[model samples]
Target chain A: MTRRQKRPFVVFGFETTHDALAAEAVLKAADLRVVPIPAPPVLGALCGIAMRIPPESAGRARDLLAAADLDPVTRAEIEDF
Target chain B: MTPEDLERAAGDSAVGGVSAYFDHAATSWPKPTGVVDAVVRALTVGGGSPGRAAHRLGLEASREIYAARTACAAFLGARRSKDIIFTRGCTESCNLMLKGLLRAGDRVVVSSMEHNSVARPLAVLARLGVEVVRVAAHENGTMDPASIEAALSAPTRAVVCQHVSNVTGTIQPIAEITRIAHNAGAVVLVDGAQAAGHLDVDLSQLGVDAYAVSGHKGMLGPQGIGLLYLNPELEVDGLLEGGTGGGSETVEMPSSRPDRYEPGTPNTPGILGLGAAVAFLGGEGAAQRDQEQLLTQHLHEGILDIGGYRVSGPAPGSPRGPVVSVVPDSGTPPELAAWLDREHGIACRAGLHCAPWAHETMGTRDTGTCRFGLGYGLTETHVDMLLDALRVYRS
Candidate 1:
C-alpha cells in the first residue's frame, strides 16, 4: 500500500465523539493545523468525524498520538468525505 | 449570574428565598443563570448527537462537550482534559471507579462514614468476594488516620473515602489518607460528592488515583450530571461498553482516554450545564465558601446554645464543611424538619440521609439528625432566621 500511495495518509477516522475531539485537541495543542470533515460511510461508521492534517505531518501526528498513548480506529483510506 | 441573565430569569429564579434552601448537600438549587441558559442552549442551538454525526450540530455538540471536559479537568487539577469522564452522577461515577478497579479477593478500605453512593456499590462488590474493611470513625464525623492505618494491614486494592461527610459536614484529612494509602501501595478513590465545589481540592496535589463528583451538590449544576477524573498513569478498566462514536471497525472496544469508559449518547444538556456551572464558580467559589463557613459557624453555635440539641461533626472552630446535622434532645428529626418548613418556610433534610453506616458512626443509627447544608447564595442573616425558626419549633 505504501509503495502505491502517492499522497500522505493525512485524513483520519474516529470511532467515538470524544476520541475525535481528543485527537483534535492533541493536534492543536502541538501546534498542528487540521481540518474536520465528514467521515464517509465507507470508513465503517455513519456520520463520524475525520480530520485532515498536512500531508507532510502524518509521521509527526502519529508520533503525537503515540506520545499521548492515544489512537483512532483504523478505517479505509479516504478518497473523499 | 450576570445582571442581564438574572433579569431574564427573574420571574422564576426570584420565586424562592436563597436562605431557605438548606439542601445543598443533597442538590444545589437555584442553579446559576449561566447554567440554566447553557442547558437551554444545548437543547436548542447546541443540539446534536455528539460524535455520532458529521453535521454542524454534531460538531457544535462535540465542541461544547470538549470544552466541558477541559473545564472539569482544570477545576479538578487534572493534567489532561480527556482524563475527565462525564457520568450520570456521582453515584454512577463511583460505581464506574469501583467496579472498574476491583475484582475477586481484593481488599478495599472504606470509612465508616460513607454515603449510600459509595456504600451500596461496595456492598455489591462485597457480595462478589471483594473484602470490605470499614474502619471505625470518630463520633464527630472525622476519621482517625490511625484507624485507617490499622485497617490497612492487608494488601488493599483501593481506599474509598468521602472528602466531606454528607451528614455532619465534616472535612476529612484527605491528603493524609491519600499518603497513607499510597504508602501501603493502594490507590485512593475519593467520593467528592460533598466536597467538589464547597472545598479547595487540587487533584494533582492530593495525588488520588481517582475522584468522583456530583454536578448538583457543590458544582452548582443540575441533577443527573457528574464528573470522574482518573489518573492516566493508572490503568483502570471501564464498566459500560457500547458505541463510543469513533472506532467502528472492530467489535472490540478501542482503547483511548474517555471513549474506552464512556459509551452511548451522553447527556448533552447536563454536560453543558456542568460546564456553565464550572465557569460560574471560577472566581466566586472562595467568597461563597467564606459566607458558607460563617453561616455554618453560627448554626453550629446557636444549635448548641438552644440547650436541647447537639451538633455532629467537628466542634466549633475546627476544620469543617458547610454542613451541620443536629440531633435534638426531645423530638424526632423528621418532625423538627417539617415544623420548621411548614411554619417558618425553612428547608432541611431528615432521616438517615442515606448513610446508614454514617448514622451509626454518629450515634444516630435509628433516627437521623436534621441536616442543613450551606452553599453559594446564603447569608448569615438567613442562618439567624433559621435558628429562630428552630427555637420556635423547639418551644
Candidate 2:
C-alpha cells in the first residue's frame, strides 16, 4: 500500500500574541520570509498568535527570534485537514 | 463580575477592569507614573552611548547612569556609588559574582530557598570542581544562620542567601547570617530580588560582602537592569572585557571598581528607568510597603479562616514580606490559579515558584502551594476577591 506524503511545516507558538507579531517583524526585517498565523487548534486552545515560516527555515526563524529576545512557546508544522 | 462592577471596584478612572495586579514578587505592576515617563524620555530625548565620547550627549548620558548608580548605592546602603556595577539583571549579576570570584577549588554555601538563577550557576560550578553546599532551611522556608555557620569550612569562599524566599516569602535573617559567614572568613552575597523594594536593606548594618538586586521586580523599573554591590575592600575579576571610555592604553580591561566589572555599552534606557524607580521608591516606597503589609496580613488571616487551607510561614506577627502561600486540601496549585483567573478574574501564581528546595523543605513538593503576592497597587478589595474565589474553590 502507498502512504500519503506530509506537507512541509511552518508556524511557531508564542506565550503572548504580541511577542509573535514582534518576532514576525524582526524576522521579516532580517530578510527572512515570515507571516503571523493564528494558533492552531490541535496544538492547544490558548491565547496567543503563531508565526508561519518555511519548513527549511524553521531553525533560522527560531534563532532570529531568540537573538531578538522573543521566545516562542513551540514550533509546529501546518497540516491541511 | 460584570464589566461595570470591575470598573467601579478598581475606581482608578484611568484604566478599565477590576485589574488587581498582585504579582509584585515576580515583577512589580503599575510602576510609579514617572517610570513610563522616564523610559519614554530616555528613548526620545536621550542620545549617545554612556561612557564613550567627549561630546555633550555622551557626558549627559554618563551623568544619568552615574545618578542611577548613586541612587542604587543609597538604596542598598553602599558606601560609594562607584561600588555598584550595573548589569543585565540579578541573574547576570549573580553570575558575574560567581564566575568572577570563585575559583575551581573554592567552596560556596547557598540556601535551599535560592532561586534557580542562583542555584543553577552554582550547580554548574560544582560540576567544574567547586564545592557547592546546600544549606538546609526550616519547614516554613526560613534559613537558619546556625546551619549556614556549620556549613562553612576553610575552603568556603562565599555564602549566598536570599533575603526573602521567592517561593514562600519568608525573610531570612541576613544580618545574623552575614555575621556568621564573615566570622568564618567567608564573604556573603545576598540576593535581594524580593526584599530590595519591600523591606529596608542597610548594607552597612547587614555587613554582607555583596548584594545582587533586580531593577524590574521590587524597584519597579524595566527589565534587563540590575545592580551588584561589592564591598570596597573586596575585588572580583571582570566577567566581560571590552572597551572602557577611559584607560585605552592597555588591551586588558581597567582595574577600577565598576569599570572592572562592567564592560561594553550598558543598557542605558533600562538604567535610566531604574534611576527614576529608585527616586520613586525613595519617596513613595514606604507608603507602598505599608499598603502591601496590610494586604498580606488580610490575606494570611483570610486564608487561615478558609477551612482546609494551610498557610505557610511563621505566625502572623513574625517578620515576613507581602507574599503568602496557601495549600488547599483538595485542589492542585495550578488548578486553583487557573480557576481564580477564569472564574473571578483574579491573577495569582502557583506551583513551586522557582524554589524547589524550599518546597521540599515545606513538604509541598508534589503539589505546590498557591501564592498570592501583594504589591504596591493591590487593595483590600482585591484581597477580598481572591479570598472569596478560594472559598468557592474549597467548597
Highest TM-score against the true fold, candidate: 1
Q: How many steric clashes between backbone atoms does each model show?
A: 9, 0
Per-residue accuracy of model 1 over B1-395 as CA lDDT, tens digit each? 55344334322345553236787888886688789899999989889988777678888898899999899899889988888989999999999899989998999999999999999999999999999999988988888888898889989989999999999988888899999999999999999999999887799899999999999988999899998988887777788788877656667776877888888889999999999989878875557767778888888899888768878889898878889998788888898888777777677799899999999998889878899988866666668888888887678
Determine the iRMS, in angstroms, of model 1: 2.6
Worst 10 residues of 2 chain B by lDDT: B1-10
Model 2 local distance difference test score = 0.78
Query: What tens digits encode model 2's per-residue C-alpha lDDT throughout B1-395?
Result: 23344335444425444356667778876666677787887788887766655345665676678778778889879977778888999888888878778889998898988888888888888888899889889988889888998888556799999999877789999999988898888999888888888888889899888898989988889988998888888878777888655444457765655777777787888999999988988885678777778788888888888877888876776778889988888878888888886776666788888878788888888888888887766778788878887788999
* TM-score, per-candidate, Cα-based: 0.90, 0.79
Best by lDDT: 1
- By DockQ thresholds, what CAPRI class is model 1? acceptable
Q: What range of 10 consecutive residues in model 1 chain B has the weakest lDDT sum?
A: B3-12
